[model samples]
Target: MSSYLLILLLYVFDQAFGESQLKLVTVLYRHGDRSPVRAYPTDPYQESAWPQGFGQLTQEGMRQHFELGQFLRKRYTGFLSEPYTRYEIAVRSTDFDRTLMSAESNLAGLYPPNGTQVFYPGLNWQPIPIHTVPQDEERLLSFPLSNCPNYIRLMNETEKTAIFLNMTKTYGDFLEMVRNKTGLESTSIESIWSIHDTLFCEEKHGMTPPDWVTPEVMSTLQLLKNFGFQIMFGVYKREEKSRLQGGLLLDQIIRNFSAAASVNPSGPLKMIMYSAHDTTIVALQEALHVFNGVQPPYASCHIFELHQDNESFSVEMFYRNDSSVAEPYPLTLPGCAQRCPLQDFIRLTRSVIPTDWDKECTVNTHSSDTDVIIGLAVCGCVLLLLVMLLFIVLCRQSEPSIGYSHVINQSDDHS
Candidate 1:
C-alpha cells in the first residue's frame, strides 16, 4: 500500500513539473474588435455611419492588437529575435479587412524597425508580409466553413434535439419580438446573435443602443450568441462536428509541429502566428476539448508550445484572455498531463482528426436514385404494354410468335 501511494505521488508530480526548452510556438488569436459586419434593416446606425465602413478595424482595435503583440514580445523575450526575420516566424490571416489590419498592427508592435534594417530614419515600423488566401479558398484559419453540406445536415439534426428545442421554446416570444423590431423576416437563437453583436459593437464604440436593446435584452442575446457557438462546435454531437470543422485546423497545426521539428537549425521556423475571428479560437479549442463555453474576447489568443528536453518532445497549451494577468493560464489536455508527450498528444487527438474530409462531407446522395426508379417504372409500363399487345396478337398466332422471338434474344441466341 505504501509503495502504491508513492507511485501515485511520483506520477502526479511528473505530470505537473516538467517545463523544458521550447522548440516551437504557435499563436492563434481573434482579430481585435471592429464594427459590426452590417446592421439590421431597422438599425439607425447603418454602414454609412462608420467612417471606414462596416467590418473595418477601429482605432481601439488597433491598440488592442498592438498591446497584445507587445505582450507577446515581452513574454517571448529571449526566445524570439529582437528583430523580425521571415525564417523565424510565419504570419497568416483570413482574408478580411479587419483581420489583415489586425495582423499588420500586431506585427508593428511585435517587430518595430531598428538597427541597419530600418528603411527610413523616421519610420519605426517595417513591412512584414502577412499571408492570406481568399475567403472561399481559406480552410486552415476560417471557422464554421460552409462547403460541407453534411455539416449543415448535422446542424439541422442537432437543432431537433431536446436541448435546442427547449431553447427555442423558451425564447420563441423573445425571438418574435426581436424579429418585429429589427424588421427581419425571421429570427432564431442563431440569427439573433447578429442583433446582439450590432448592439454590443455600438456600445463598445460609445454609442447608445436604442431603447429596445435593454440590458436584459443584451444579456439574453449574449446567451443565445454563446449557445450558437456551442451549436456550431459543441452543444451536441460535438466530436462529430469537430471532425467536420475544427479538425481540419487541428490537423494543420499538428503537421506544423512536424515541419518545425524537421527544419534546419540554421534557418528555423520557430513560430506560426494566425490572426482570425473569435469563431476560429472556439473551433480549435473545441477540437482540443478545451473550450471554455463562451465567446473568446477580442484579441484573445491560444498558444501551442512544443517543448524539448534532450531527445523527447512534449506539448503545452496556454490561453490568454485577460489583459490584467501577467501570464497566460496553462491548459492541460484531457487524459494527458500539463506537459503532454508529443506521441500521446497525437494519439489522444486522433479520434477527432478526419481521414477524408471531402468524403465525410459527401452525403449519401445517390445521384442515380431517381433515374433508377424512373427507369424501373418505365420498364414495368413497357412490359405491361407488351403483355397487352401479346394478347391482341395471339389471334394472329404465327406472326406474333415470330415477332416475340425477334424481341427475345434468349430464344434467338442462347449464348
Candidate 2:
C-alpha cells in the first residue's frame, strides 16, 4: 500500500512540475527616440538643426534602450546566462544608425563587464555582435519594401476604395491648409505627418513650437497621422498586405520557435532580438490581428515566449508599450487561447505567411508580358535570318551566264 502511494505521489509531482518549461524567447522592439526623418519645406527646423542631422538616434534613445536591456536581464534572470555568451543570444538590427546603436546600447545593460570578460577596469561595456544586411537588400525588418510591385498595386487599389475616397474628400480642406502653411506644392495624409513629426520631436526635445501650430492644428495633424498608419497597414485588404509585409517576420519567428521546441535538452539560442522601427512592430501586430491601430511608441517591445509542457509546445505573446508599467500587457492571438498551442498557432497564421515573397510581389501580367515579348523577339530573329539566306541564294542564281562564262575562261587560261 505504501509503495502504491509513493508511485501516485511521484506521478502527481511530475505532472505538476515537468509539464511546462520555457524553450525559447524572441523579442522585436522599436528603436528608441530619434530625430525626425525629415523636416517639411516650411518648417523652421532644417537638416542643420539636429546635432547629428536627421534620422539619427539621440542620447536619450541610448539610455532608453539600456534600461530596456536591464529589464530583459531581470525578466530572464535564470533563463539567460548572467555573463554574455555568444552562442546563447543573437541580435539583429535594421541597417540604420539608430537601430545599430540601440542594439549596442541595449547590450551594454544586458551584459555589463564581469570577471575575466572585462577588458578594461573603468569601462562597464564590452563588445557584442549585432548582425545586419544593407538597407536596399534587407527584407526581414524594412517597412513598405520598395521591391514589391504587387503591394504597390494594392496601394493603388486601396486609394480607389470608397472608404479611402471618402476620407480624402473629408480631409481635402485640411490638406490644402497644410500645403499652404508649409509652402509645399502638394500635401497628402501621409506627407502631412512629417509636419506633425517634426513638431512632436521638437516639443519632446524642449524646443518651442511655431506660433501657427495651434492646439487645434496639432490635433488635426495627429488624426491624419493615425490615418496614414491605417492606410499603410489596416484600411483595405489588410490580411493580404500583411502576408507581404509583417508576415515575413512572423514566418521567421515561428520557424525559430519550432526549431527550439525540437531541440533536445535546450537550444543553443536562448534569445533572439530584433532592433527595428515602429512600422515594423505595427506590421507584425496587424498580421497577428492584435494591433490596437495606434502607432507603437518609441522603445515599444513585442515579445514571443515559447513554452513546452508535457512534450507539447505552446506560444505566448506580450507587449510592453510604456516603460512606467511594471509588467507588459498580455496579448492573445485571435481564435486561440492566450497560451496558444504551437501547431494551432502555426495553422492560424499560415494564411498570412507567404511561400515565395519575390514571386508573390511580382505582378502576374508583367511576368507573362515579358515572356511574350521574349518569344516574339526569338521568332522575329529566326525569320530575319531565313530571309537573308533566301536573298543570298536568289542573288547567286540571278548572276546568270556572264558569271559562268567568266569562270570558264579563267580556268582555260590557267590550264
Candidate 3:
C-alpha cells in the first residue's frame, strides 16, 4: 500500500509541476552602434564628420556584435546541427544601412558559412539573406512620434498625472538651469535625445565635442533618454499601445519554430537573430515584460533559450549587455510558473501580443446598405411614437365643445 501511495503522489506532483522540458529558441536584439544618420544645428557630428561617413557602423560597434555572434555560436555549438542549415536559423534587420551592415557583420561571426556552401573554395564567408521592411511600413518596429488627435489627448492627460507633473517640471527646470549655466541655447530635452547621436558621430570620426558637455551632463542626459523610453513604452496613449509595443510578429516566429520542433523532434531553429534599432529592442522587451527603461547598448541582445524534459517544454530568458562579457544576465518572465510550461508561456505572451494595426478590428465592411436600412427602420419606429404623442395633445386642446355638449345633455335630463 505504501508503494502504491508513493507512486500516486509522484504522479500528482508531475501533474502539478509540469513536464519541465522542451527545446525551442527565439532571440530579439537591437543592431550595433553607428554614426548619426542626420545632424541638427549646433551639433558636433555632422556629415563628413566621421571616417566612414554618416550612417555607417563604427569599428567598435562592429567588434561588439561580432563578439556577440561568436558568443551565440559557442553557446549553441552542440545543440545546433553542423554546417548551419538554412532552416536552422533566421536573421532579420530593419532597412537602414547601419542595421543591414550590422546584420551582415553579426552573421559573419555567427554562422560564417563553411564546407560545401563555401563556393570560393578557400574562404568560408558567404552572403546570408537579412529580411527588412520599408521604413513607412515599419510602424511595428519603430516607435513613431504619433501625431494623431487621440494620442495628443493622452499626452496632455499624462502631463496632468502626478508622476509626470513632478518629473516634467523638474526636468524642465533642469534644462533652464543648464542653459543659464552653459550659456547655450540647447535645452536638456533636445540634448538628451540627440546626445548619443552626437557623441557617436564625434567619436567615430576625428571630431571633438565642445567643453560645455561635461561627463556628468552626458550621464544625466542618458538617464533622461531612458525616461523617454519608459514613457514611450508604458506611458503612451492607449489606442497606440498595440502599434508601439506589439510583439506578435516575434511570437509568431517562435510559434513556427516550436511547431516544427514538435513534428521533427530533433532539429529546429536553434537561434534567431534580429538586428534592429534601439527602439525595436525596447518595444519588444517591454511587451515581453523585460524592459530596462534604457536604449540597449550597441549589440545588446535579449536571448530566449528553450529546454525539454520528456514531453513538456520550458523557456529561459537571458540578457547580454556587454559582448566582451562571457555570461548572460539571467532574467525571469513575470507571472510564469517555475520552469514555465511551453503552452503556458504561449498564453502569457498572448496577453501582450499586439493586434494587427493595419486591419481595423472594429470595421464591419460586409454590413453596409442592409445594415443602414435596418438602422433606419429602428429610427422610423421612434419617429412614429413621437408623432402620435403630438397628435393626442392637439386633439385634447381642440375638444372643449365636446365637454359643453355633455353638460347640456345632463341639464336637459334634469328638466
Candidate 4:
C-alpha cells in the first residue's frame, strides 16, 4: 500500500511541475551594425559615403556579435561535447557581405579554436561554415520582399490600416515641422533610412555634416528613422504576416528535431545556430506570439529548448539580449507550445508554411466572369498566325529576286 501511494505521489508531482530534459538548441539572431543601405535627398551621407563606404559592418558591430558568440560558447560549454565537435553545431548567415562578415567575426569569438590543444601559437580560431543564399533568393532570411507584387499591394493596403494611416499623417506633419524649422525639404521614409548612414559615415571619414544639422537634431532624426522601421515592419499587419512566414521555417526546423528526438535520445543535431537579421528574430517571436514592439537589437538571439518527458515532449523559449549574461528571459510559445505533446508541436507548425504570394497574385479574379481560357487560346492562335505572316514578309524582303527562278530550275532538274 505504501509503495502504491509513493508511486502515485511521484506521478502527480511530475505532471504538475513539468520536468523537461533539454538536449539541443537552435538560435537565430540578426547581423551587427551596418552602414546605411542608401542615401536620402537631404541626407548627410552621400555617394562618397564613409571611409569604408556604404552597406558594410562597423567595428562596433563586430565587437557586438563577437561578444554574442562568446556568450553562446560559455553558456553551452557543459551541454556541448568537449573540443567543440563540428558536427554538433551548424551556423548559417544571409549572403550579404555585412552579414557574412559578421558571422565570421562572431565565429571567432564563439569557437576560439585554440587555447591549450594546439601546435601553433596566437591562433584561436576554427573555420565554421556559414551557409547563405543570394539576397534575391533570400525569402527565408528577409520577410516579404517589397519587390513582390502581391506584397507591394498588401503594403499599400497596410498603409490604409487605421494604425498605419494615423502614423503617416503624424509623420507627415512632423516632417513638415522639421522642414519649417531646419529649412530642409528632405525628410521621408526614403530619407530617414539614410540618416544613420550619414552620421556613421561623416564621423568615420572626418567630414562635417551641413550646418543645418546639429548633433541633437541628428539624434532625433535617427530615433524617428528607427521608429519608422518599427512601424513599417512591426505595427503593420501585412508586413508582420510576411515576417511570420519566415519564422514559420524556424518552427519547422524545431519540430523536425523534436520528431527526431522522439525516436532517439542522442542521435544527431545536438545544437544549431542561425546567424541572421534582426527581422528574423522579430518575425519568429511574433509567430510564437511573443513579439516586442522594438526590432530585436543586433546579435539578439531567440533560443528554442525542446524537452521530452515519459508521458510527452515539450518546448520552452528563452531570449538573450547580452551574450555575456548567463540568465535569459523565459518566453512562452502560444497555442500548443505552452505545454504540448511532441506530435502536437509538429502538427501545429505545419499549418504555418506561408502561402506563396506570387501564386496568390497570379490568380485571375476576372476568370469566373468570362471564358477567359478559351479567349486566351483564340487570342494566342491569332497572335501566332500574325507572327508567322510577319516572319515570311521579313524573309522575302531579305531574299534576292532570283529565288523563284532557282526553285523552278531545281524542280525541273528533279523531274
What TM-score does candidate 1 reach? 0.86
- TM-scores for all candidates? 0.86, 0.86, 0.73, 0.72
**Can you tell me which runs of candidate 2 are displaced by over 4 Å?**
1-18, 263-267, 365-415
Residue pairs clashing in model 1 are none
Candidate 3: tens digits of C-alpha lDDT, residues 241-315:
434344545456556646744856544555667777777777667766677776788788887777776656677
Q: In model 2, how large is the Cα lDDT of residue 146?
A: 66
Model 3: CA > 4 A from native: 1-22, 121-124, 144-156, 176-191, 200-206, 235-244, 261-268, 355-415
Clashes of each: 0, 1, 7, 1
Candidate 2 local accuracy as lDDT? 0.90
The local distance difference test score of each candidate is 0.89, 0.90, 0.67, 0.66
Model 4 whole-model lDDT (C-alpha atoms): 0.66
Comparing 2 and 4 by lDDT, which wins? 2
Residues 310-369 of candidate 4: C-alpha lDDT, one tens digit per residue: 556666678887655668777765565455566665555554445554554432446633
Q: Which stretches of candidate 1 lie over 4 Å from their true place?
A: 1-19, 262-267, 365-415
Tell me how far the alpha carbon of residue 341 in candidate 3 is from the true structure, in angstroms, after superposition. 1.4
Q: How far is 375's C-alpha from truth in model 4 (Å)?
A: 7.2
Q: Residue 250 lDDT in model 1?
A: 91
Can you write out model 2's per-residue Cα lDDT over 287-374, one digit (the tens) per residue?
A: 8999987888888999999998976999999999999999999999999999999999999999899999988888787778999999
lDDT, model 2, position 92? 96
